[model samples]
Target: MATPEFVLSLREKIGHDPLPLVGVTAIVFRDEKVLIGRRADNGRWQPVSGIVDPGEEPADAVVRECREEAGVTVRATRLALVQQVPRITYANGDQVDYLDLVFRCDWVSGEPHPADGELTEVGFYGLGELTDVAHEHVRKIALAVAEDDPASFVGGR
Candidate 1:
């Protein structure tokens, strides 16, 4: 996994200190199937996600992450969720509490491909048939698919 250069630099100065960060994840749907990518580092399938870069909008970040990670273009249909995750420590010794924004996205174009080094596989799956996804992620997808309102938020309080 290639850690961002800026993040790596910050870790050098403040080793493992929990930095509060923001990120976005896209639940991209095409033909009623949601897209999931197998992470290269963990080999587990999850939605396309990434940290919201400095000065970037969360919606824009999700679109960019989807294109880079899965070689697919998407448009945000709604801001689906906002969750402030407690501190999470990565195997690489980096720590952060992420305010992750989940976006319901509509697929615009392109097929699934591992365009970036982050993912090894990218494919679509039905909501009831997902495997290898984290427990919270399963709920996230289900809520995104079932909910009609744009302001719906799913997170542990």
Candidate 2:
């Protein structure tokens, strides 16, 4: 299945339109493992993330994305990082500039499974095993899980 037509239409309408899009991502860890999703579109591993809806807090969006992508309910502990990646080019040739807020979250309940169609697989992985992650920032977030600082956000280097 492809992305819903509504989303595609919206993307086309807003392509290069110069609007601020807010998104949220969650770094969920258990023991030494971090939850990651294999994106069906790119076949690459990344954290659970999605666009933040209007009027919703970034923390709420983080929890919602965790539940939707990883099939787990998580409680966001704190805002970990704010990333501003200017001009991201998508696979479809559209460009999006975004301000992303990442949160440090912990699983509160639910089982691990890929609930959203965007993810082909879902699992917890150790730092040593994450060789094929989609981006360096994601890898940094995974490494941050091992650090003593719980409030650190791994902004893009």
Candidate 3:
């Protein structure tokens, strides 16, 4: 998707100054594997995630993101984890800090594929097979498979 309208308008006023944003990631599991994707914007091999639109519930945003980015329908089963991202400078020069909401979701329908410009590839992966990703992602995947309750991982990283 294009840069969010709110964000674009905000940038027009404040330039690239870092802003705190909320986002959601999906840990969509099926059979014995979890869904992951390579971001079209950054080539990051990670879980499907997106910035939450203004006034959107985090879980709803995650489900919408899963479909938009990965072409899969998912039912979020639980809030999985919450992670605080340090400031990041996007390649486009927009800077932001993200409060991340990670959700554990069950596969609902459709095969994983790059459904939009936000993703270049999408597939299910076994935990042992995930690599070259941020350690927190790996940790969240492992946690999702092994736990039932939501986890709060306040981080400084």
Count of residue pairs whose backbone atoms collide, per candidate: 0, 1, 0
Clashing pairs in 1: none
**RMSD in Å for candidate 3, one decimal?**
2.1
How much is the lDDT of residue 146 in candidate 2? Answer: 49
Model 3 scores a C-alpha lDDT of 0.86
Reference-based lDDT, residue 115, model 2: 89
Cα lDDT tens digits, model 2, 10-50, are 77788645446787878887777788888888787888888
RMSD (CA, Å), each prediction: 1.9, 3.5, 2.1
Clashes of 2: 1
> Per-residue alpha-carbon lDDT of model 3 for 1-157, expressed as tens digits?
5889999889999998998899888989998999988887778899998999999999999999988888899998888788788789988788999998888999999999898888888899887788777887887787677547657677655
Clashing pairs in model 3?
Answer: none
Ranking of models by lDDT: 3, 1, 2
Name the regions of candidate 3 deviating beyond 4 angstroms.
155-157
Best by TM-score: 3
Q: Which candidate, 2 or 3, has the higher lDDT?
A: 3
Deviation in Å, model 2, residue 47 alpha carbon: 0.6
